[model samples]
Target: MFDQNFIENPYPTYRALREAGSAHWNGDFLGGAWLLPRHADIAPVLRDARLSAQRSHCYSALLPEPVQPAFAEFNRVFGMWLLFQDAPEHTLLRKLMNKGFAPQVTDLWRDAITRTAHTLIDRLPAHGTVDYMGSFAHPFPALVICELMGVDARDQAEFIEWSDAIARFFGNPASSLEVAYRGRDSLLAMTRYFEAVVEQRRHAPGDDLISLLIRIEEDEEALNGEQVASQCSMLMFGGHETTRNLLGNGMLALLRHPDQMQALRDDRSRIPNAVREMLRYDSPVQYLTRIAAEDFEYAGAQIRRGQMVVPLIASGNRDETRHADADRFDIGRADTAHFAFGHGPHVCIGTRLALLEAEIAFDALLARCPHIAAVDTRPEWLANFGFRGLSTLRLDMQTQPADAGAVAA
Candidate 1:
């Protein structure tokens, strides 16, 4: 079905789909999926404001009937949150939420990100190998969000567990009902937890994002406690999970290609470009599906209204028409446009924070641990389809510490 074997790896499958034509839909398995690889086709689809991420407009009906109720319920609760809204409503939600993600806010976080990088790495085991994903990458953003949200230190562990379980929806197919139910319960628990936090902030606020949200609420009648809570929860989970994969997956890219790693080590300034290369080479998010609001002709196939349309973003990153030697991982590639952060109005609002966190984290890791290599042991892939990353990436490092002073000298 795929040019690439779907079981082991799907990139080859995506490549073949792209080669076949611009937008191709295959009903082979997983309830049918489409691949919109061409830029010309993807741009129009994203710009079309009538479509949305809501389940009602879902391009894919692969989800079981029972599962839709759970998802639909969650969608109803989070309706005002930007991720679920479209067009004019989406614009308002995005505008408000983006206040916290403004350029000034992102710039303010540069130093905090640096400190976070150092603090996380310093805690790693000195000589023995460690699961960089668990010990470092995942927690890095979690800590940042905790501090940013004024989450009590005591509650941090619970938050991680809740996030992990809710994250499983996108993970590989569930083993049984128990897992899916647990994941749903975790999502509800998290929503309730944040709901309380939002109320708490309303009564006894601090100088944090939550407080700012309350202030936004007072000024705008459009927002309320439930709205604020939903948005905050979305930001918390989205920021934490997507970035965890970015740092962890980006590091994996470097380990798999030693030459690029060496270059970053030799000239630290190249870290910025190297980060972009990492983004293009191994995007954090693999696929994004957008529902077609109306019938549209694409790649010789006719798409019906409310049909699910998935942009195989990972495939688009490697489309020969868009990128030269698309499969090759070259840090020096001039033309780079990977849908890592997505595209269009619904694009990731936390992109600046994400990129900032990645740049600082990568710079610190390479500067601190030289000749770092993926451990001989098998690395753990987080069993999620919505995202790709290591569950636990054990890595070997240079026994000698490479502190700030050592690197400078």
Candidate 2:
């Protein structure tokens, strides 16, 4: 599964896994784990309190005996992330963090998100090949998250570097010790950067997420300084990495299926549904890891405690039992149920925000670049199993920004 072929397309492997059995124990993945490829089994595991999200311990355990101590900080910081926490702590942190991520708050950024997308699209070459991932996909979400966090625009490049390093490590289950080192360094750098920003926000609060977190700490006394900074790091990495991949993957899917692209262009209302299909067709997040909280019977297999269980989200999204014509990519498809953002307690809190960003991004791209096509038929996918996305997407775009009269209309 770590080969180039699987990286380019893992759905076939997922199908095989699902057909072979309900769950297959693979000894190679993250030091032996059970892979759940079917939706029926994965859905319940996500909501089951018996499965724990605290899988940071596995990181150090995967490292060499000599270098294990180097990853202590990495384990500590990652364990603090909202994505890796369970009830009680997870519940309280989510409630306090909700003040900044609620739909109402997300709606406030519609104009900003739209404007950012258009700005990036406008910079693309009118009649030549360009890498959309660099010009737009990667930076669009990075800039929006930066604006949300009140970070200086000049710091965007460094932030992106930090994000990429952390994402590359976490998203690759077969990552090397070298990758672990880079991830640890980047994580620490980002945490320190956010810690400084948090101090500044403390002295002078603004309307951004940092300020909101500081307020949550002060008013409720729920979060310490380190915890506040940890959330900032998590949000910064999560907010940018997943959304960037979605834009890239969605664009590639549209380029591959012209009819679906035309459907979206024909009726702008379909953009939302189109976004959902894009998610299902090629999810940015391929799977999620959980530790068995207790011994339990699942799919006729007895799972021991402290064992790693992986829910293949991308596979479940393509499950024929749950979705009609699951393999097909149709923008107009009515069914939007998917585990792209996950399910149950650990479901992505930025679901609405991610959808909104993709919607605005596609709308702006189609509106401005009436003619868009991939430069190469063979796509280049990032060498990662856990995170499915393109490494680079070159495209030919003919720009035609809407006229002033049309905008007014």
Candidate 3:
């Protein structure tokens, strides 16, 4: 599954897997786990109480001796992340974190998001080619999240590098020892950076997420220093990683289908629906891991406790039973119930923010770049299986004049 071809396009393999069975036993991958590829099966399993999000407790025994120590730092950092927690603990943390991400708070940033999008668009060359991913897609959200988190503009590059390094550990459990050590170092560095930031906020808070988290108290409980640092780390990384890919992938999808691009450009009203379809067509996050907390019978297969259950979300999005003509990419597709942001209790906390960011991004891009075309139709894909994104997306664009009313409302 880690093969380069599979990383580039796993849909073919996913269809084959789903055809074989709803769930398949893969003893070779991740030391014996069940790969669930069908939407009929994956949807329910995601919401099942028996399936636990805390994989470390279930898969610890499978780790090799050398990798276990490195994972100690990994777990210490990611374990506290709301995505990996369960039950009351998950409930508590989510409620506390939600204060900083309230809809009103996110809505307030719309103007800033639009301004940021326009600022990045203005930097694009009028008639030259540029790698959209690096120039705009990647850094746009990174800058937005940094502003929200009270991070210094000068340190944006370092923060993004740290987040990228840490993200390697996800969806690639069989990573080499070198990658494992690098992830460990990245985690340690993030921990130290956030630790000092949290301390600074505690003494003298600001109007950032870190300050809000420090002051937020629910049921007489508040996030401690360690928890504050961990949540900030997750938000800083999680905030932009998937959203960056969404922008890149969404634009590429539009470029591939000229009709859809024209439809969106003609009617700005279609941009929101187009963003939803883009997420469904090529989800940013492809797969997630869950562990069976207890024995359960699923699709005639007996799942044992402590066994890994891998849900192929990218495949599920294309499942025929759930979506009509699933293979086709239509921006106007009515059924937008894709599992791109996941499902059930663990759905992405930043879903609202991501959607808003993508909406504003596409709006600005279409308006500012009157004629956008892909320089390289076949761009390289990221090696990680968990997150589906392009490594680079080169594009040649024709920028509208400054007074051409290209600025998004």
Candidate 4:
């Protein structure tokens, strides 16, 4: 299943997995893990207390025992991430982090996000084919997250590089040791980069997430400087990586389903629903991993402690039992229940920010580009099963006049 065909479209494989049994053990997947395919099974497993969020051990098992110690920095940074924590630790860190990501705080950046979207859109060619991934999808969120994190917008290239390396290793279960080494280097580089930024913010604070984290650290003494920096690296990665894919994947969906695209263009209010459907239809985040905290029977499969549990979020989104016409992409569907951003405590903390960014992005794109068509109807997908996204999406667009559209990019 780790072939190009599966990478291009894993849904058929997901359907087969879901239909065949409740769970299947794949020895090659992260050195052996139980794959949970259905929504009913995944939903509860995500919330199950027996399924621990601490999967660093599972990650370490990917490398040879002797080489594992070389990834100490990788494990250190991963430990600081709230996604890999469970129970009281996860609860406390999430609460502390929430202060910075509060709705009111996130709302303060609407103007910045809008401006970034338009600035990137403005750079697009007037009447020619362009790779949306490079032109808009990738850089748009990178810049936004940079602004919010108090990092230099010019440093986005390095940021994307570091995140991509780590993602490539983390997302693909079949990653090589060489890929693991690259991911380790990237993670360490990013952590060191943020260490300096965090130090600067300590002396001279700014109205950004880093400064906010520092404030939380000072007030509560819950996190140290290094931990704060680690969170910054995590946030930077979480902030853009998935959102970038969402923009690309969502736009590709619209380009494929002209009727749905027209529906949103006709009524801008449907943009929100359209975003939801886009997430459900082709989720950017495809899978989430967990370590079985204890032995238990789930979906008729006997799960053993220390075993990795892989929940296919993309598969769960398309589960027929929960969603009617599960395979179809309809923006107006009412039953949009999905694990796109995941479910339960470990759900993506960047969900609200991501949704707002997508909403603003689609709104601005539809308003500015009156006529848009896919340059390559069958675009190639990245060989990444976990973070499902197009490698590149070339679009032929008829951009509106600079002075047109009251939407004000």
Every model's TM-score: 0.89, 0.97, 0.95, 0.97
Give lDDT tens digits, candidate 4, residues 1-409.
8898988788899999999988999988898899999888988999999998888656666788898888776887877788888988888888888888889988888888888888888888889998889899988888999998979999999999998888888788867898888888888899999999989998999888888888884245567789888888888888878999999989988888899999889999998888999999899998999988889998888899988899998999999998988999998998777799889998888888999999999988998899899988689788787898887988888776444445443
TM-score of 2: 0.97
The alpha-carbon lDDT assigned to residue 105 of candidate 4 equals 88
Residue by residue across 1-409, what tens digits does model 3's lDDT show? 6698998788899889988888899887778889988998888889999989987433334467765765666676768888889998999999998888899989988877888888888888887889999999999999988888888868889877887776665656576666666766776788779989999998999888889999999999999999999888888878878998899889888999999899999998888888989998898888888988899899768999988898889999999888999888898888888899999889999999999999999888887788888998589887777778888999888876543344544
lDDT of 2 at 211: 86
Question: What count of clashes does model 2 give?
Answer: 0
Model 2: which residue pairs collide? none
Identify the superior model by lDDT, candidate 1 or candidate 2.
2
**What root-mean-square deviation over C-alphas does model 2 reach?**
1.7
Q: Output the lDDT of residue 17, model 1.
A: 71
How would you encode candidate 1's per-residue C-alpha lDDT over 1-409 as one tens digit per residue?
Answer: 4321342256777776776788776564234555676655666676676556764223113356676566555545545457767766777777777777779867876766677778778787767778788888888888888777888756767877877776665343322455555655766677788789888988999877777776763245556787777777777778888888888778887788788888788888887787777777767777776666777676666888766677767777777777888888877677767777888887889888888888788888877776588885456676566577777888876534547664332
Give the per-residue lDDT digits (tens) of candidate 2, residues 1-409: 6688888888899999999999989888888888999989989989999899999768668878899888888899889999999998898888887777878889988877887887787788788988988889989998998988899978888988998888878887667887888988999999998889888888989998788777774255467778889998988898888898999999988888888888888998789989999999899999999999899989767889988899999999999999999999998888978999999988888888899999888888888888898998887887777777777899988887655543332
lDDT of 2 at 82: 90
Q: Rate residue 128 of model 3 by lDDT.
A: 80
Model 3 scores a TM of 0.95
Model 3, position 329, has a per-residue lDDT of 84
Off by more than 4 A, model 4 = 217-219, 401-409
lDDT of 1 at 237: 77
Off by over 4 Å in 2: 217-219, 402-409
lDDT comparing candidate 3 with the true structure: 0.84
lDDT for 203 in candidate 2 is: 91
What is the Cα-based lDDT of residue 19 in candidate 3?
Answer: 89
